[model samples]
Target: MKTRAAEGGTGGVRRRPTLLSNAETWAQLAVAARIGPEAYAAVGTAAEPGTVLLTVNRPGPGPVVVEAPFGTRLGDVLHACGLRPGDSVLVGGYHGAWLGPVDAAGASLSRTGLAELGATLGAGAIVALPAVTCPLGEITRVAAWLAGESAGQCGPCRRGLPDAADALVALATGAGGPAGLEDVRRALGGAQGGGACSHPDGTARFVLSALDVFAPDVEAHIAGPGCGRPVLGVLPLPRGEGARLEVDWSRCAGHGLCGVLAPGLVRLGPHGYPASTTIPVAPWQEHGARRAVSQCPALALRMRRPERGPGRLR
Candidate 1:
C-alpha cells in the first residue's frame, strides 16, 4: 500500500496479505523476514501512512492466523492453548474481569472482553481461573464494584445495580434463597440495557454470565444449602475497600415494608422482604438511597456507596 505522510513528507509503501483471505500470510512471509508486499491498495489521500499495524496470534497448536492487533488478549491466547473447558477467564483491560469455563472451543475472545472483563485487546484477552475460587462470589464482588462505577445518569442503572449486588452478596454468603433469586431477576430487568453507556449492561452481563457458568453454585444456593466453601476473590478488582450494604436475613422477617417505601429502589420478593436493585446509586440520589436505607423496619437494609471516585468502581 502506497500512502503519503505529513505535509511534504512521502509516506512509506507497505505490503501485506489479508489474513482472513490468506491464513498463512505470516507463516509464508515469516515475522522475522518482514518482506511481504502490499496486498491491497491504500485508501485516504495518501498523505498519511495510516497507523501502525499489529498482528496478534491466537495461541494454538495449529496454523497461526493474525488478528488485527498483534498482541491479542493474553487470557484468550491461553484458552486457545487448551486451558481446561469451563475455565473462567478475565477479559477487558485490568478493570474488566469475568469467570467462565471455555465453553465454546472456537469462541473468539473479542466481544467477551468488555461485557465480562472491563478490558478487551480488540481481539482476545487474558484468561485464568483456579479451582479453589468460587466463581459466584468473585462475580458478586465484581458486580458490586461495577455498580458503584456507574455514572448514575439513568434511573434504572443508578437504582438497580446495588440491589443486584446485594442479592449476589446474599447468595454468596449463604443468606439468600428463592426470594433473592427473584430479586436478581428484577434488578437485571430494571438496570440492564437502560443506561446511555454500557455500565448497566456490563454489570448485567457479568451477573448473567455467572448464572450460566456457576449453575452448580446457584443450584446449591437455591436448595437453601451452602456451597461449603469460602469466597476466594480470584478475579482482580480495584484495590482498597468499598462501601457496602448489609442485609440481616435473620432480622428481615419478610415484612415486605421496604418495597413500599421505595418502589423504584426496592422490590418485594416472593417471601415478602424487600429486595434491592442492582443499579449503582448515583451521586444525586444519595439522599433517596439514605432514606430507603433508614426506613427499613427490619433494619436489614443498608447502602454502601464507595468513598473513592471512578477508579474505585472499576
Candidate 2:
C-alpha cells in the first residue's frame, strides 16, 4: 500500500488538512479558474458548469474513463463508454449506489439529477456490474475491504465493521440465515455514528441500497443455497481498525447485565464481581459488545481507543 505524510493529523476523518474534494472536482476548478466561469459554462449545464471524469469498473474498452458534461444523460455516458445490455451501472465510486438498465436509461449525471433517484454523483466514477456476477458476493468483498480500512478511532467502527462484512459473506455463501441479515443490519447501524469519518455511513448506504435495488436477488439467495454466480470482484477495495470497552469498577455495580446480554464478549467475575474490567471487542462483535457496555446499570463503561496505530487489529 502507498503511504504519504498526512496533511492533517494522523487521526480522525478528513485526515488531510487540504480542502479535499475529488481530484476531478479540483481539476474542474482549476480549469474554470484558468478560463473563467463564463467560458467554462459554454459546454456544460448552467447550474453546474463543469465536466466529470467518469471511470468504469473493468479493464474493457467500455470501462475507460471519459470526460462528460454535467447535464449529460447517464445513458449517453454509458453508451459512449460501451455499456452493454443488462449491465448495471454503479454511479459514484465504491460507496456509490448502482443503477439497473431501466434506471440508468433515464438517469442523468448531474448532482441534482442523481439526487432525484436518491443517488449521488460522488467522485464521478461509474462501474458497470455485469449481470453474470453474483451481486451479493461482489458486495461482500467490498464490505470486507471497507472493514479492513478503519482508522481504529471510534467504538462501533473498529468493532462492528468486521461483523457487517462477515454477515455479507455468509449471506453470499448462503450460510447466513435471515438472522445473519439482521446481524448485518445491526452491525451497519452500530458503525454509522460516532466515527471519525463517514466510512461506515457511506458503506452502509451502499449495502442497504443494494438490499433495496436487488431485493429479488437478495430474496432468491435467502431462499436458495447460493446465487450460483461468481463474485467477479467488479468493485475495488483498498485494504483498511478502532477501540476497546472498559468499565470503571468504582461506578460499576457488577449488575452482571452486560454478561447476560453479550456473554460472548463480557463475563462476570466470581459472584458477579465484574472482576475483568476490560472487554476487547472484535470488529464482528461490535453491536452486542456495545450493548453490553451501554446496558450496564452502573453506567461505568467507556470506549478506549489506542493513542496511536492499531492495537489488536494490527
Candidate 3:
C-alpha cells in the first residue's frame, strides 16, 4: 500500500497518521498499531507502515495483497485472493454469514456482487468460516443485534426485529422448539422488505441466510435446541444515531390510518403492515404528522429529525 501525507494550507506538510488498508485488514491493523511494537512483539505480530494485512480463513503459503477491481464485492475480493467456487464464504462481517460453500466463480465483491448472492458487502466485510463453526448460531446472533439496532422508526422493524431476535436467541440458547422457529419464520417473513429504510430487509436477509446455510442447525434447534454455544457477535453496526421516524402498525391494523393521516408519507404493505411512501411529509404537514404519532394505539410510531453537524444528516 502507498502512504499519503496531508499538506496544510499554510505551506506546511504533515504525514497522515493513519494507514490505508482494506476494511477488514485496516480494523485489525488499527488495534495492533495502537499498542506499539512491544505489545505487538508480545503477540508475535509486527506492523509494517505501508504493508496491508488481510484475514483470510484459508490463506496461501505466501505474501499477497489483493488488488480488487473497482466495484468489487466482498465475495469478489475473496476470489481475487484465490477463494474458489463452492468454498465456504462468510458474508456481512462476523455477525454476517456462517453458511455453505458459495460459488465464488459467480459471486462479485461489490454491493452488486453480494446482492447477487442474496447478501450485501456491508462495509465491504467478508470472512470465511470453517465448517466447524455453527452457521445457524452465527446468523441467529446477528439477527438479534440487527433487531436491537432498530431506530424504532417503522412499526415492523421496531416490533418485528426484537421479536425475531428473541426467537433466534431462544434457538441459540437451546430453549426454543419448532413453534419457536415458526415464530422466527413469522417474524422474518413479516419484517422482510418492510421498513422505511433497508434495516428490516437486511435483518431478514441475515436470518434467511442462517436458515439457508444452517438448515441442519434450524432442524436441530427445532427438534430441540442441540447446539451448546454462546452466540458470538461478528457483524458491524452503523456508528452513532441514525435517521428516525414514527409509525404505528397497531392503531393502523391495516386500517391505513397513516396513509389516510399522511397520504404522501405512508402506504399499506401487502401483509397489512404500514409501509412508508417515498414522498416525505411536506414541512406544512409536521403538525398533522405529530397528531398521527400521538394517535397510534400500538404505540408503534415516532418522528425524529437527525442531529446536525459537519456531514451530519440535514
Report every candidate's CA lDDT.
0.56, 0.71, 0.55
Task: Write model 1 residue lDDT over 31-122, tens digit each, in one string.
Answer: 42453234221321132211213232222432243233232334445544555444555544223345455433333344442334443333
In order of appearance, the predictions have TM-scores of 0.55, 0.67, 0.48
Model 2 Cα lDDT, one tens digit per residue, 256-278: 88777765456465678543455
Better of 1 and 2 by lDDT: 2
By lDDT, is 2 or 3 better? Answer: 2
TM-score, cand. 1 vs. native: 0.55
TM-score, ranked from best to worst: 2, 1, 3
Model 1 misplaced regions, further than 4 Å? 1-76, 79-86, 93-100, 104-106, 110-127, 243-314
Alpha-carbon RMSD to native, per candidate: 10.9, 10.9, 13.6
Q: How would you encode candidate 3's per-residue C-alpha lDDT over 1-314 as one tens digit per residue?
A: 43343432233235334444566676656766897745544532132222223344443353244544334334555666675423256655543443356454356445554565666545434556444455566666456446546566777775677667666766666666777778788987887777898778777766767676667767876676565544443233343333334554344465555546754344445565664412233344466567667775566667765466532543
**Top TM-score: which candidate number?**
2
lDDT of 1 at 224: 61
| Candidate 2, residue 311: lDDT | 36
Query: Where's the lowest-lDDT run of ten residues in candidate 1?
Result: 43-52
Candidate 2: which stretches are off by over 4 Å? 1-23, 59-63, 85-87, 237-314
